[model samples]
Target: MAKTKAAAENESQLADPSVDRKALLSEALRRRIVSMEMAPGAVVDELALSEEFGLSRPPVRELMRQMAAEGYIELEANRAARVSSMNHQSLRNFFLAAPLIYIATTQLAAIHATHAEIDELKAIQQRFREAIEQNDVENRVLYNDQFHLQIGKMAHNPYLMPSLRRILIDHARLGKIFYRHPTTHDMEADLGKAAGQHDQIIDAIARHDAQAAGDIVRAHMDLSRRRMTEYVAPVGVEVPLAF
Candidate 1:
């Protein structure tokens, strides 16, 4: 009996004494959710995760609670946790709220970002660029999430950070559509532009130019909306659905 690639990787991680098993488990769950491997409303069994990650029930439950708080999953009494569902209403609210939150937080980040935070953002952006160049959809999505999340931290806004975290969960899930399976020229072009925009955002924040940061984020959101729209309703479709 041969171990699967994922199983092998998990074993290797477990072998590493320096590794943070809890963080690794958290990141793995996030990647699965963002990549749609654990699709919307899919049940996440506690015991299965506990076994798979070689973690005890307590740590697994703690991770589940944290993920639930971050909008990745929903928990109910006596029922298994499930990934958050995205339907018409939730999608509508997402669209309505995403841009405002992104722009506001980005502007605030520009005002409050420290030099160390800016440096950290640059490191994240480098990984984002590498992910794009490699065409690794999952890594691309994950790093993109990290990039925005770092900015949210820089915002230093208690009120906005939670909303931003919640918003990004859907953003990455929806992004699976945008970043995966669609190899159209437009998508490729948009990908390049998106990476460029990240750099621009970094620049804006580093300069403490709130206006510039807000404007660049507006364009970035527009790119995301347009990319998602194109995927949902391609050029050949008679009726294109707008996101």
Candidate 2:
């Protein structure tokens, strides 16, 4: 079978001698997997990656292992690695767990975030706003992931950090639906609202108001859910039919 256009582009990037091949490969894999270019549960071909990047099997396997630990991919004994699947059970669990984790982390961030960490989050938020303005969907997803991951770090809870990181992987993946391909006016509005909420989160954290931060995070989660629903079941006219 022939390679897809994305695969061709990835190969081209890997051919650049001035770049760090491993870093390039990892970043490309994350973006592709999160954006559905690789698709959930897609097989990760270790041999192909090794050959394309001019890496040995051990390094390729090591990279895959790192991705697996980060919730980007999964590995099993005697089987090929696969992009983490977002099936019904997984999504249902995400819905059940995400708000709790997000709220917990944000509340903790309110209590523990240092001034410098808040500055870093503001910087990420600035980039996020720029992505939204330019309709740069890929950067929006990546920056949004970074935004939440920074909050997780500020939370300073070893127990919650892992769960927060894991849920954020799916968050970014699901978010691509609305961010990348907005189908309605509401989605565009929600993007603005999300940006506004980030500002609110920063303010609340800066003030050390845990309750307010938690409340803002809840509203943020609701906005995300609504946008995703609008994407899946968009409001419109009747379906076309031919007799």
User: Residues 1-243, candidate 1, lDDT per residue (tens digit)?
Assistant: 987565578789989888888888898888778778888999998898888677899999998998898899999998879999988788879988999999999999999999999999999999998988888887888889899999999999999989999999999888777678547787788889989999999999999999999999999998887776666676784666796
Against the true structure, candidate 2 has what lDDT?
Answer: 0.88
Cα-based lDDT for every prediction: 0.88, 0.88
- Show model 2 residue runs off by greater than 4 Å: 1-21, 234-243
Clashing pairs in 1: none
TM-score of 2: 0.86
The lowest-lDDT stretch of 10 consecutive residues in candidate 1 is 228-237
CA deviation > 4 Å runs, candidate 1: 1-6, 16-23, 236-243
